[model samples]
Target: MINFKIRYTLLLFAACISLQACKKAWQDHTAITIEALNKTLIQQINETPDLSTFSTYLVKTGYDKVLASSKSYTVWAPTNTAMQTIDAAILADTAKLRLFVANHISYQEYFTTAPNPSLVIRTLSGKNIIFTPATFEEAKIVKGNVYVKNGVLHTIDQASGTKQNAYEFMMSTGLSTKQRGFIQSLFHTEIDTSKGVKLYTDPITKKTIYQAGTTFPVTKNTYFQRVSDISSEDSLLTYIILSDVAYDAEKAKIGRYYNLSTSATKTDTLTQFAVVKDLVVNHVYTIDNLPDTLTTVSGVKIHLDRSAIIQTQKLSNGIAYVVSSIGYQILQNKIPVIYIQGELPDSVRVPSTLSIRTKKDLNDVKYTDMQSRSITSSPDPLYYYRYKTTVNSAQYKVYWRAVNDIFTTSFNQKVDFSATRYYPKAVETPLATMGYKAVAVSDYSEVYLGLYTPANYGTLYTFLVSATGVVSTAPSALSLDYIKLVPVN
Candidate 1:
């Protein structure tokens, strides 16, 4: 979150749009303009037979009386058809019922006669309501002659900001058409896989499926980026795209028992060391790894961090190690992934003169592979470049090759970045400032709390160079984002 109050402004603006839509009007008989929606009240909302289940929810939540009050509201009234479409069982549940419908209301005064075609309104629920593709005619008279009523109502097709993240658990093996509980609060949805991209269908809106390989439209706070399966033929990598939020899996108390090869029991917590390392090590262990189908389980997912176990040099009977950083920190054999989302209009031709700076006192300089792909007009923002530098006395090798989004896989000392485009308007002219930045850490492993060390001190910097992608040997000082000292215990 930007920690800025930008949204507060939008909320107020939306309310103004909705409230102003249906102006109050006085019939030739009544002198004062009054809200028209008062005429078409929510007369009777029957939860019994289900003409509109949401109306029943409004009644149950005590909002029915609230609506009857003088306070005006803009309700995204779902038709009886939409209401009946909800599962009968779900409609019967009082809890799910409240959230489903109560979340739809806005308190901005809208009259039944408001003629405005398109206006954004604020919900009593404080959600912004944008009514588009609409019109205004005899509804709320414009300007003078009418000072407008307290409220008006305008029908709208869609309500904005619906729970896009609501996971419906659409389709999975053995999962019944009958709704099981939603994958209780899905954490991160994507995962890195040895078996290409993986996908899962949302349970509710069954049609929407999330596939890996590329960015999926972010839904809700829990964006379904990728799904990695340890219960598969290939289980070394854990797939991750963009997680909707920093998932708190600990309290969720989710996930199933481990599915080791030689186990019959479902919840076994201990296994031999060899089995531990083989089954799980570098892969990202998560809470949602449980499958709907039953599976044999052996050994628990170990967390050997300070929070979990006392630190010592002794090799664990189990191989799991927990670090502060989330997900897979270091993959012995990295899968270098890069995707060129969108590139600049002009072709980027790197100036022939290029220089590589191997930071001193740093062992390994890890730049996966050079990618000339499109993301933003800029190339750096398009790809994530990690340099897993070692402490000292280590050789670094890098080669240029065309790569997909995964870039950590192969390295040949000789490289060809020609296919890769330079970000921020590829420098063609002999340049001075490129604003390229890098974190020259001693070791990425040292960034974690206890694993860090004084030797891990590194610099984050931008380099000045020629039109070609090389650090200018002669002209300029290196600019740094900030240099920090990280200490390892």
Candidate 2:
């Protein structure tokens, strides 16, 4: 009985020890599994042998900390073999290396099972990468959807080479020198108050005043704001870089309207801006899909001569074509028609006596017309509607719409042009011998005025004179709706 009792006691002790050992093993296994689930993107990359090269680059660029952060990111890590193909020069330069690594990482997590078939994602380097289910840009995705604590990681078969954007391409020296210099010269800096902390509120103006030294300087280019933003990766654009010869030729054709100043420098600057303003179109047209003509964002139609292409560069945000010749029609695209509203004249003679009547025309379009309220019999009472504007040194055909609905008697009117505001000394002959006679009844149609050529490109004063010496009521009074000056090339 003693032997049996001792054996039972030993068996019970052994079973308790075995149960304790199994419990400890299960606890350790759970701890390791939880640790693997908590691994970050950087940790995952560092552990993978195939992505060791990319992991080394991330450490060199100090982007490993960025990946380890709490913010979500998607990393397209290149395999060890793929990293070998990268340019040595890029790795040598810190800026290039940083940019190259940033190009592979994006802000948000991306997965292979995304709803969209393809996406143009802006990377941390400010460049766009084309992401599809099967590829990252030109690189084939070897492994994807490897989720980490903060983001997802994907292994790529090859590394995508960094390409310059449209704006960056223009910044390159020795390429489109004139256009690049002009664009660079437009760069200026302004204080960004939003980046600074508020110092106090102004009591007088009720405006928040930011701390003077706290504000950061922001670089701005007028071309980017007024024209296309070629630096942006959100939209694709087609940029045309004109060669020096083509630029000069196009500038000369469009310089007539911009010849407001006598200074050659001022005229050249204005002409240059006008010439380059319409060069960027808001669409990407590859060489194979390029159309015969491209309409610019500013609505100028330009004929594209494929033969004139000096070089074509595929950019990250867009494509650029360096062309030696681009043709623009002077009359159709360069010069626009000028419309002068009679009610909004620069200066009018006898303002108190003139009446501005607002009415609707046959097309139910609302319009305002100017009419003379003078009822004097004085000969040539100086009852004239004068207007001032800048004009090119070109011939123009004038047309006017003067509705005579309130007038019972038909009256005559004529137009005169001069460089100065003084009366007489006509630049060109008046329309007709008796001038234009208004219809006795209602007439909403425009009357044709004879062609008048300006002597030079400067401010011009036009006088719309009424018939001399006539007592006038609403009828027989001078009336004008608007005038149109159509440029004749």
Candidate 3:
């Protein structure tokens, strides 16, 4: 009887302990199972009755694939109430619907960490969308920080496209749309494939290597193609476009120079073509922000009329500034003028037979009698040729053609230039003197005018050549052809 009682008591105690252990196990298992059942972005949308419309649109548009992916993303989900304002026509169109959904979805998580509170995010639709936490807070984060297998999801009261990139905004307005040529010039690239083998010389080895013939197929560059494909995230560009009024006025200047017909293509070298090209190229800058002044690819200065800016747009890789005017008149025979001896205008032509005679003025200042000659005679004599350049920097390299006298002895003369100086001091000083050995008429000398720096603030800078020496002396017969001024950085 005692044994039976002891066995029964032990069995009862064992049963109670096992029941307690099973209860604890059940609690742990239930907790883990609950965690596994947590909602994903797709599930959350479907489960929430308020989000039914958004979920249905996602299904209808097939954006569920993005949500189903394991890759991380942050979705700025708009509630059914907020989405009610969206046009049904937009949702019905697959293309529009896809882009609309993509605009709301960001590829990276933003609620916990972002580069900025108002971060600029690129969506799958190839457009930039602004995601501002503060702005979202104004409407309230209806559902905040719901983590799923892929990423965290947030429901916002409202969200829409707030900003357009450089390209997008340029397309948004009719006025800016006409300025497409300017935008196109900023991001243009040419790909040329020749029909023959390329002979490349190795600079280090000084050996020649010939590649196999690439001539089987030739590829040419098309301007229209470049204009169509203008946006690149790799290279940042800033563009300044003339407003419609400004562009039309500038085009009128071109029409005055060249006859414009509708048949003329963009590539046509009409008088307005080069001017427009320079104007467009002058607007492109390799930087992101618009400074007071910027240098173009052609090394021309573009002054920003801040007060006259008609429109401004920011893009993934650059910014665009639209202004009423470039703050300067478009002039011809501008910087980088190349004058050939064979092509001289009668106004600036110096005759070969004229021998210059030096005479003293009342002040004992030596002057030359150039009454019959086209050249101006003075201590600082002026050449018949004039090249107007915009001095954006402190120095520019001047290259000129000088003809040597064949029958006379060689004489060294210091050639000085007069230029509108801008920096260090705004005074007209003798541009540094450079030496040129005049060669025989059969041969030409190409020498640099060493120290020609102009300080004219984006205005037309004129470079006048003046030589100091006795013109009547032997070996004094020198012919001047052309002077080219190239801007130095």
Candidate 4:
């Protein structure tokens, strides 16, 4: 059976195709006069009340003169109904309305449809718009494509102040009282950065807001209670989305948002799984317009343990500004290092080789602390697991690919990994062939890398052979993690 969202997807796809044709025609033809097109559009608007905002928006945004000239484009015009919902005064103002209509105008006619998320679109004002279709593509596409005489318009549900896809609704209104109430109800303290995502008993109430194996701290509010609180008794607990696992083959890695959550339609591509599980415990949600209770704002680099963000700025609601004589400036570079472990293990033995999964788990197995995040832990959290050995069947093989090509042939320097030993990580490295080990890696697990990941995350030289492998020569792709646990029988 077709999903309900598919029809919407097809509509968006059709709209895109229409715009794409216009763009191609504009680029291929000579001086396609905008005056003729605008005349037709104005007539159409006269007959259609819904197009009034489109007409008014054109005039207010200073497009009358330009559209009356020679700019061939197609715009996905919003109906009068859509415009009626928007404030007329806001729509009537030239400068103010630009923000609302910014998504409507692309620079050229060629960009008739949304490309894959990576495709770049230059707006009429020369700004760039990225089409992100990670989730709800049909909804997003429907919201995005609107065609007009001179250009196409994509009508988003909300005015995302910062061009982010994560929080469209949240961006529409800044820091709602309900959101604030939610945060305050959990804990008054700022996020414990030492833990990427945190949860625990309320120090005051001891209500067990947090439970074992949660991601970010879940709230007692409406949103969380529905998804997480299966039993009514499960209510009142705050769950967190934790990205705490070491280079989890399934999760991608311990620290990052990219490639973790995806919506792919291909048969083999996985979809609908919670990239972020249990909202409150183990994850750090990216919040914009932090509440007024948060004072003396200072920016610090935050690592997202496990997060699913629309990553867009909602209307900057209720976000007060204070003038301190300092502006944002970029300076020194730093990277986060984690020493993964829990409590010390009592029994210990040395081995010849370590599996890859244990190493990744060790890297991810740290608890949030007071001083800093998982750099290392008490009695050193690093000394829990040791490297044993690679599978005896493991083969050292040369995987080659095209580095460059002059024609159909003739390329220089195919990517190679000869000197590097691809060892299974038992723990985060400073690895020793002999002597004592720092971290005790959990066994029967595995780590895998992507096409790209920041350095110092795991072993740079040796990558573990995982249950899954992509055909990439990048460091992240080769990096793998492994651990051992029981199977359901």
Candidate 5:
């Protein structure tokens, strides 16, 4: 038994020694692998013959010490030919040299593992670099997947500069209210508290009327801002701009009678949407597979007329093509519909009801604190809501809803819309319903308002009446819910 115990102790001692040796061998192998991979960015650049020129730039800029330190970074080391093309003036200027080198280095490594990828990387210089991925046919990713102690390295044919894109160029120049108001109708009118009332003499009646303030608050559109953002990488876009002279000429031709500088009023004839659509909707072009004819983000078609491409800019992600003029075809039958809410600033209501309701929700009538409108705690006698709106179109239709209530019998009278010459109607209906019904008020199937070409932005007035053929104001009780405007050819 003692002999067997001694043999077992010796066997256990040998096994322990063998285990230590195996552990040491594995540790040595790991150390060798780590040593092989451990190389600083500067050291790697020094070792490569093609990167000799870039290394000199790094040394001149004193960025070598930055890479030697234990900080992670992705270096897009320029090839020898690219470095040779660097301007001598950049090398002479210390600040410019630092900026140029800093632009090439990113904070983290990005390997070419994904297909057709795009990423916005921030460099040491704090400038954003948009890295666009390409296929093998476009440019081979030379010397990729280089793992160093700090980060990774990838070589490319060319590096992009911080140039503004097509949309950015336009925004930097500034946009006009006339240019922006087409998409958002609310911008058409602005409030000026300084001017209370300006008296204007009526030519035919020799009567004086009051005009309210005309200043509007400054605002921006998010849709256009995003479209012009340089960091947007989801899709490439091509923007075409009309020069100042061309824009003014087109504006004059379209708004010859309409005064776009002053406030839009019923008396002024304005070709509202037609000119704006012709200018903005047709100017933009999107690039997909580089087609000859491309559609805009707003769904307007644009022909890639080579003769029309007067100016062109090569942006990092897209192109900016400037055209001399836009081909605008005025389709008389295909005009867009315009809706004006009763709550707009230009609208006025008299003997106003205590409650107001939106077309969105007819059942709920809530109290509102809107400008240029009279408010009451209870429904007032001779209650009428009269609003005058300017239209670019020559024809429009007004739609209103009649709601019934417990006092339905008291509201037995017809809600006449065209009792005044201001609102002409082709179809008229009596307002004697205890329920809800829409009434279309117009003189013709396509009602004609004043035209801007011959007149001023065609001025039109819409009013509510409690009785038929009742001119002037009469003692009455009625509810004026809402009014909607639809354009016609």
Candidate 6:
């Protein structure tokens, strides 16, 4: 009986030890499971002692629910000390506070070990924030890559300040008031057909008709629609805003080209738009990397003088320079060469009497040229091919290429200019003294016609007239390939 009691006591001791070990294992497993469930981004921010201010603002902005949801996000949480520097005006306004908070969060979970050295992250506020392993914008990351259940969190030393884009900067700055006002004047409202409500179908035309007032009016800017959209944060642009004195000076130079005898108001508006149109370039160029010459979106080349810059603003979207003056020459870059093809004339004296021939030249380059057909009559019929274009008030040097490949004999042609489209009663003076005389047979070279200055800045009519009106059955006719007018100051 004594031996049986000893064995039973030893078994009881072993059983108690196993029970204690099992309880300890169960407690460890429960702790791990609870930690895994509670370590979401919102919870992680709430638990961090230094991130209390950031956590509070997230809840106030209703972004706490967003971080707690399944969608991934990266939060650059500023410490309480960093939050102390925030503007009191931002906290007073709900919309401003929400925007300020949203600026710190982005859509994706970006870790510090990302392959890219830097990334342009689009934040929840719709503005872009630059992110690097060590920093977010100007704010230094104190503790980074804090992984959570939903996203990653990085503690920052300072809050990332919001910046205005190029368009916004121009509107807010007092120096750019003239440019801002001009751009604002281009705003107009148009009916948005996509938002219209369908009423009924027309029985006769079998078309759907929408309610008259169902569609809303959406405001649009002509400069934004037609030119580069500087307001968009997705693109980068370099905008130059001239001071009021410089603006008036630049307007005076470009005003001569847009001179209208009809309306003074229309002339002023055209001059203002032209001045503003060539000021915005597509790429962002800082003063350090700026080239000596930059081309505008309107295809005008402008000389960049660093000394002329009064203020330089580093915006979120791009850079803006307030300049005292812009260097733009009138003739060199503003006026472009005008080209007119012989076969594509606006009107011909007799369409049936002209033949457009396509042939290869001496260089084996294929080209199309217009040739006069057989006209057997007295006072040899003069064939006229008229071309029209708008010219600035500048002298133009005329050039023409008349390839005489079909006929063995050479032919002659002259050019005449007029303000009206219809044939003038008296033929104006010829462009060249010799009238592009005797275009050699089979010679495919451009002949220079002397310079001619237009009387005014408006629509110009160019008439290519046959120099010698020879009525013959043989192919001794005037032939031309193209005409070019190069502007001279």
Candidate with top TM-score is 6
Give the candidate order by descending lDDT.
6, 2, 3, 5, 4, 1
Looking at candidate 5, the ten consecutive residues that score lowest on lDDT are 442-451
* Candidate 2 residue lDDT tens string, 117-166: 88888899889888987799889887777778888888899998777889
lDDT of 5 at 117: 66
Candidate 1 lDDT at 281 equals 37
lDDT of 6 by residue, 293-366 (tens): 88999899997799999999887787899998998767747777788888988988753468898888889899
Q: Which candidate ranks first by lDDT, i.e. highest? A: 6
Residue pair clashes in candidate 3 = 195-215, 404-438, 404-439, 422-455
| Candidate 2 CA-lDDT value | 0.79
Cα RMSD to the true fold for all candidates: 25.4, 12.6, 17.2, 24.0, 13.1, 11.5
**Which of 1 and 3 is the better model by TM-score?**
3
Alpha-carbon shift of residue 343 in model 3 (angstroms): 28
Give the Å shift of residue 176 in candidate 6: 2.0
TM-score of each: 0.27, 0.75, 0.49, 0.27, 0.53, 0.78
Error of 1 at 377 (Å): 46
lDDT per prediction? 0.30, 0.79, 0.52, 0.31, 0.50, 0.80
User: 2 or 5, which is superior by lDDT?
Assistant: 2
Q: Is candidate 1 or candidate 2 better by TM-score?
A: 2
Off by over 4 Å in 6: 1-38, 113-117, 192-216, 341-388, 416-438, 454-481
User: Mind giving the per-residue lDDT tens digits that candidate 5 earns over 191-307?
Assistant: 443544657779999865556444335455443443333334334556655655555555665554344445555213234443333322223244433456555544445455666
Clash count per candidate: 59, 0, 4, 96, 14, 0
Error of 4 at 110 (Å): 4.1
Mind sharing the TM-score for model 1?
A: 0.27
User: Given candidate 5, what's the lDDT at residue 297?
Assistant: 48
